[model samples]
Target: MEHITSTPTAKAPAERFTGDVYLNMIEAPASPAHLASALVRFTPGARTNWHSHANGQILYITDGVGLVGTRDGNVVRVSAGQIVKCPPGEEHWHGGTDTTLMAHIAMVVGDAEGDGTTWLEPVTAEQYAHALSSQGGS
Candidate 1:
């Protein structure tokens, strides 16, 4: 077994996120392994751009309330202790609600080439508003 030290928290790029977002890299894929993980924290109204994994992704909510939106206009509210799964190549985004901070542990499975995620266009304001309305807020 290998012991891994904690890494510094990073501010998520504005191009791929809104509001304040930070990520702590927990584990990276080692040779012969294709799994990576991170602990991500989001301030109110912060969110990631639409993206998908080459293999798949799993998110375990650790604190506060959040929203997960899909390409088909489906927005779901997820809370602490809930687990959300995104199938391989399924376009989706996750983030904190307008009124609360959110954090989750994201586990991503990658392909042989270590390509885990493909990020798409940022979620538009209209889309976010529609999602919030659909769920009647977080």
Candidate 2:
């Protein structure tokens, strides 16, 4: 077994997210394991753009409250210790609640060619507001 030291957290790009977000890359496909993982941190009201994995994605929430929404306009509440799964090629977005910070460990299986994800457009403010309302503004 190989022991890897922790690396500095990097700010997630604004082009792919809204509000403040940071990421600490854990295991990447370049390692012996052909999977990628990262610890993502989001400030209140922060969120990711629409994206999908070639295989699938698993999100293990580690702290605070959050929300995950699908292309069909279904937004669900996620709390600490909860896990959310996104099937292959399913477009989705996740983020912290308007009043709480959130963090999660994201795991994704990469394809043979090392291509794992396709990033699409950012989620609109209208969509986010609608999601929050769906959750009763919690």
Per TM-score, the best of the predicted structures is: 2
Worst 10 residues of 2 by lDDT: 27-36
Per-residue alpha-carbon lDDT of model 1 for 61-130, expressed as tens digits?
Answer: 9999999999998889999999999999999999988898999999997756764899888888888888
* RMSD (CA, angstroms), candidate 2: 1.4
Alpha-carbon local distance difference test for all models: 0.89, 0.92
TM per prediction: 0.93, 0.94
Best by lDDT: 2
Structure candidate 1, residue pairs in collision: none
Query: For candidate 2, what is the lDDT?
Result: 0.92
How would you encode candidate 2's per-residue C-alpha lDDT over 41-136 as one tens digit per residue?
A: 999999999999988899999999999999999888999999999999999999998999999999998956774889899989899899999998
- The regions of model 2 sitting more than 4 angstroms off are none
Cand. 1 Cα-lDDT: 0.89
